[model samples]
Target: MSIDRLFPNLTEDNQAELERFGDILKRVWPLKAKHREKLKYDIRDMSRGLTTERSERKIDYLSEARFLSPYLTYFLPWNLYRMSRLFTGLELDIPDGSEVADLGSGPLTTVMALWMSRPHLRERRINFTCMDRAPKSLQAGLKLFNAVAGENSPWRVRTVKANFTDHIKRKADLVIAANAFNELDWSGRVARPQAEKLAQHMAGATTETGRILLIETGVRLTGRIIAEMRTQLMQTGFKPIAPCPHVEECPMPATGQGAPWCHFNFSVKDAPTWLQTLSAEARLEKEGVSMNFLYLSRKGGKDWGAVRIISEPFKFHGGRAQYACSHKGLTLVDHGEKQRPLFPGQSLVPNWPANPKTDLKSGALILPNTKEKR
Candidate 1:
């Protein structure tokens, strides 16, 4: 079926342009794709190839070159929106006039998006230092920054091609590691080791109430990774600021649900030519699911707990009612309570309760969050 038939009065050229839009957005980061398959290998290479101090460093310049692979092209169009939404619930206390250093700022998409989202912050003396060892990734980030913000922007931006191994002496109000931790698989077992180092770097902020958001990718919108993050942060000084509410970890996915039980997917509005054609045949087989794990701890919390992981429900605009839930993960304590806003379609469709309603908080869904799991 032709798009012309679906959307009338649209010229063939307009339809073609629309198709081109979707095509470009579908591309994934090619270099990351290879890294994903052999993440462990990449970590090992980094450890063996570079000096001990440099190899264990927080930021690396190689990530940018890796992102340049053809696979990453698909992420161009909606990458900004996706990342912004991912970090939406993050309520960090980044002080005014704070200079932020985005360590391992791959593609600069998130940094640019952050600036764009908080235009007011740009007005203040907020200097963003994108530190990474990868020249190609940093260059790409700089290009994106320029595209979003023309030659004359109040925000001061700089891209560093050096890794963070005592080479630079600058301290920042806030330090972040965006999507950089996932690269540990690129080298191997070093992912955990590298994350330990990165965690330390974020804690080394120069300003008062130093804050950090160790954003981890969800298995689409599931909460498992979030749990892992909580534990990792506890090992350090970090504590849970908030849960990536979109997909909070639930008990169902791990124990109750069957294989491939839960997943998530998004609509590609301007799908490129191939996708436009393929999407017609591309029935909604399953949704693309992911979860976010966040960790934040101040100077002294007395004692800290291990981070917990949970599986969250998938998120999207409009879909069938059935796709909106999985109660097998809900804890017994909150099992029969009034539905909170977190339940899917709670806002739109009223009186809809989670099926079975037996998910236990003990299982990754809810942890000892004195801060109330948001």
Candidate 2:
């Protein structure tokens, strides 16, 4: 079977609805079992304070989410939650085929799937790296890449064991941070170290399209996170992209259903098949995985801000996922959609003329609907 056939999407000419169906199926039979439930608990880890004057004390590469997925969000499928970030972050035109790096890449399978599915990026020579401190997780991530993408994947896959807390490594064109940040055990942040490490990489890295992607579970942390995230990324010289919320003293203020907070919930109807596929595909075989997430980001060199629209429908054409999301706060119809500058600090729209042009009044948001024609 052609690789593209396995993963689906929506398009202008043809739309596919079955892919969402497939994603939903996994919710019923999550591959992780109780571990999935455990991620939901907000309390600290039970395995902390294990050090003593005996037997090389070891902490699982986690301060929390031990035996759990970073932050438990049973509402949405974990994979889908990550995918939605692209639209929400206004990173639609991520310089196709550009070099991309995934810091603290966990179990490369999922991210690899993302790379393989994006044909536009495949044509570009991809410089890929996965860094993590845990040998087990790194090893698992390695195996994941090989299994998910056959033997002849094009991207250059490299692994390294280093602390994200310290400065290290050269950056690539684009940097990716999955759920690695929130998993830290340190006070202030479980993931802040990783973010700082990423900044170090940025200092040394040469990026044609300088950009960073940070996606995390968005349940309890939803309201709690909005402002803090904006501040941290700003410290790194980054701004929020469009189709997202302008949280950091955002100047563009208006009255609307506050940029929709994206939440991912597995399709209650599609869980069984997803569970069965996991056994043959990834670890936690024959189980389900779900995550409700909120993604925020500013595209490279853009002053535009963005906040994910929770619960947006995935529309397909023919059978491909062309138009997968519809950002909130903005609309397909611009007949006086009241343009509002994202923030008062905003001088002019950033990256204004790229593939994803922005309308100031409506703020940076998805361009009309991207849904495939049925």
Candidate 3:
């Protein structure tokens, strides 16, 4: 399975649909011309806060109009776009009338993405409970969701003004916390008490056959936090479904000094041009986006016999190479003749030769799997 098979390629039709969604967003939340001018400054400030000054102490920025407006206009659509890509890649097995819980759901971004990406679930009656600490953001999200959903929508949405750490009242078929856990600060250490607690809360809220999806920014610190949570969740009886071919110890060393973290990068070429202009005007141009994610279930996941590519293609000895993780742990895959280049987040199933060579620099097995196909 080439990494291309794992994600939706941006066909012309898909690009048109994305543009239409962007139009819908503008229609639902139109800002005055002067308001747009001020929004850029607000976006710059918020971007700085999220990336540079990510302190452990939490702030209610969602409640402030200055922050909330820019967030809804700029950050919300970008996040929704990112989530749509993720949803398209996933294989959701939700039943009719299933319940979904979105923790730290700022303006129902994940809920909207699920609805847009998975049209097959539109007819089914799904109950969505969005939990957040900011009432203003929740209210804005509810209104926007209703406007986007329009009349006679089968999905029911309700808002709860509470923190994500609060105990969930019911077990849901799917529990999603996109960009939520990154709010919890970490010390870049492998072991943290927060990961254990968050895993417990997520586990408690998931049904026996349900699935949980956690997404965070693709940064070194966030990678360490997710790696720790992966261990914690496995100890709590959950198995990772995606991004991990085998449940063996993660070989992407997300800890220690200057260790490389595990994450994936996705192309943003399909994003609407208007959005790109807005982002550039705000001084935050995004050519691509990166995320560290984990999808887990109590029951086992897809039949696993493939190598998941974790790093981008890099030059190796005058040839192309990529870092992949498989049952054999971390590996350096040397591209073979006529083999298509593998991108991050893609998986490849190859016939491994006996006694593969080992790379001295990275200490990873070298697999010259050429002419391999799914």
Best by TM-score: 3
What's the best-to-worst order under TM-score? 3, 1, 2
Candidate 2's TM-score reads 0.51
Predicted structure 2: lDDT = 0.39
**Distance from true position, residue 232, model 2, in Å?**
2.2
- Ranked candidates, highest lDDT first: 3, 1, 2
Error of 1 at 92 (Å): 4.3
TM-score of predicted structure 1: 0.55
Clashing pairs in 3: 1-374, 3-346
Q: Compose the digit string of candidate 2's lDDT tens values, residues 1-374.
A: 00011012223211122234233233422446765444334212322222122133343433233432331122223343334323322334445455666656655533553543344554445667766666555664565455434567666677776555444355456666665554444334544554455445553453544666555544433322333444455666566553334433532221124543333333223333443343233333323233332233334333233222223233322221111122233322211222321211111211212455454533544343222212
Question: Please, what are the lDDT tens digits per residue for candidate 3 over residues 1-374?
Answer: 46444456554544565567667767777888898778889888888888787572257778877787888888888887787777787777567888899999989988877776777777889998899988889888887777766778989988998887797788998998888877765764525678888889888999998888888768887788778888888888999888788888888757776566788888898887888988999989997888788899987567557888888888787778888888898888888545656878788876688888888888788888676656
Model 2, position 221, has a per-residue lDDT of: 39
Backbone clash count, each prediction separately: 67, 53, 2
Q: Which portions of model 1 show Cα errors greater than 4 Å?
A: 1-72, 164-168, 186-193, 220-229, 244-289, 299-374
Model 1 lDDT-worst window of ten: 1-10
- Reference-based lDDT, residue 49, model 2: 26
- Candidate 1 residues 1-374, lDDT tens each? 00001111223433353344333333322244554455334443443443344445444434534425321333322344344444432444455677777766766766765654444455565678877667677776676566556567667778886454333356777666665555443234644565565556566654456666655444432233334444455566555443322233432332223422222233234233443333223231213323343545554322222221222332212211122222223322222222221332111212223443322323323211122223
